[model samples]
Target: MTGMKDVEVVVAHSGRATLRVGDVFLKVDGDPANADIEVQAIGLAPVPTPTVLWREDPVLAIAAVPGRALGALGEPSTASPAAWAAAGAAIRTLHDAPLPPWPGPDLSDIRSKLDRECEWLLANAVLPADVIRLNRDIADAALRPYAPAFIHGDLQIAHVFVEHDEVVGIIDWSGASRGDAMFDVATVTLGHEEHLDDLLVGYGEGADREVIRAWWSLRSLNISRWLIEHGFDPNVRGCEFDVLRARAQER
Candidate 1:
């Protein structure tokens, strides 16, 4: 345990807030179902996860896991290649496990959401039209049919923790569901492209390069608007805006 420390606000938005007090973290969700799913995901995941302390109403308390986050958006990761690989290994284990009973958004739902997001982006002139078009094209590849697997649904790299080149824990599993494996992989490597090979080494088969890249674009496109609405900047260096622009320049 990190021992007693003053309360700190880890994150806060209109919808939810996460606060850290001593060695325990408290997450308060706007939607109670999110907290319920988080509890279920922690219990179900095969890989290391934060230990749940208790749940009451909209709040969930969990003991802080050992180690630090692997990385954060808009920041280059200083974590070792082996640490990335260890996170990949954990992901592979999660995906290879039996599918979760709940299903995530289907291809049609995902496409519809992306289309709506793009339309909003274009209407608001939030991003260059060419860049949006290019990313939309890249995102199409991920819409194809594939056998479903248990996915971390929102496997942001920041959720993974590491110490001494080993993944000690992963947190924030509220989005867990039966879904695409590549999506989980892409989410982790979103802004940190250099670590793709290291992650793929541990994930092994089915790490389709093209599909994974497509998910990167798709994820960036989907989250840009939400991030902005939540008072976060998507244009930060190494973030969603740069991700789309970088891919657009390649074509």
Candidate 2:
């Protein structure tokens, strides 16, 4: 064969699956509108994003960006503190950019989801009722009103890439929307709370610490079941379950 590369499944579930082949990444999304948003968001974001190679109905092809991910969810980051700061700076730039034309989920939607997830966690015995209750209380802080900004709704640590203390790229733009900028920060800093200080160095002022912590709980609650059903484990030592338990200890 002139050229052949082994295909790797980066992630997969019912709604979406991402595959990597050589330097190209193909994402298959159930909803075409999400693909539309990713394309538009990359164009609008001030920070570096994957280069869209092509798109067909349910699949989007993008050129791979350079550098390694900032970190994994359940592990320590090898990326330098300065790299985290650079990511924070990049996020700030994105938040300052003009909002995407598409509308994002509103507060009511989030509130309803929270209520629904809490019920499920209890019904399924996902965790201790007390632990869930404590976290649900902490998660309250994030439900309040905040000025919206362009945000990467799923800015998990692995989504940001860095090399030599500089943020070279951020991937997975399907979740980008108009939302709380702090939510983006908290999402990126989840599991690795120690780097929050360094991240804030570049993020600048007006980022509330309390709200960020609250987001940790809220986000853990929101995604735990989805991760489980998608064949991912959120119960590992430093993952989402730990994030929830850590909050309980603080109370």
Candidate 3:
């Protein structure tokens, strides 16, 4: 770990910090267990993930995955439809893989959390009461039990990298666990709803659109407060607030 000349902060927060030094990424998690989970999850993933360079307590160094992120939230994607499809196919492969040793939150836990989040939203006046109620009703479908699959629990678009219409890699495996596969699909397509058709085409047919939409509501409600607390604006164009508002309009 010499020549640390061009160290750039990738992300920093109370829970974790990530830095880039040359071609390597150094991640420091507040919990050493999270670092351990990341290392193990990367090993279990069926698709390309950053190579672990080394690990020391809370710090883990990983070689950078190639290519840019698929796209950013609140920004238009320049990736071709094929690239999006490739990402969907990659997710399909992950879902089809043997389950990770760790299980994610069960449906009951998810429902309880969703109830708490909805209460928080209403108490804080985060959205119109009617809007929150409508979305909560819509979110119920997603809380039903489904056979768990290996999932990139936080499959945001920015975590999936692509080059030349192919998936180069997926990053941030700290959240990987056995969970509902449609949750991954909903997460990647969040804020990029127009591309859902392309992704589903590659993921194979017969996905439950209602459950996917329910996940959209559930995820949006669940993360909005955390995003605001972390100094990020969920109200930004094309972000969570817009997603909620759009769902309201559909009601």
| Candidate of highest TM-score | 2
In model 3, which runs have C-alpha deviations exceeding 4 angstroms?
Answer: 1-4
TM-score preference between candidates 2 and 3, better one: 2
The estimated TM-scores of all candidates read 0.97, 0.98, 0.96
**Candidate 2 minimal-lDDT segment of 10 residues:** 99-108
Query: Each candidate's lDDT (Cα)?
Result: 0.92, 0.92, 0.90
Candidate 3: worst 10 consecutive residues by lDDT? Answer: 1-10
Instruction: Kindly report which residue stretches of model 1 are placed more than 4 angstroms away from their true locations once superposed.
Output: 1-4
The whole-model C-alpha lDDT of candidate 3 against the native structure comes to: 0.90
User: Which candidate leads in lDDT?
Assistant: 2
List, residue by residue over 120-220, the lDDT tens digit for candidate 3.
Answer: 99999978999899999999989887889999899999999999899998999898898999999999999999999889878986578999999999999
| lDDT ranking, best first | 2, 1, 3
Per-residue lDDT tens digits of candidate 2, residues 1-251?
A: 86879999998889989999999999999899899889989999999999999999799999999999999999999888899899989999998888888777788899899889989999999899999999999999998898889998889999999989999989999898899888999999999999999999999888999999999999999999888888888999899999999998998
Runs off by more than 4 Å, candidate 2: none
Clashes of each: 0, 0, 0
State the displacement of the C-alpha of residue 65, model 2, in Å, after optimal TM-score superposition: 0.5
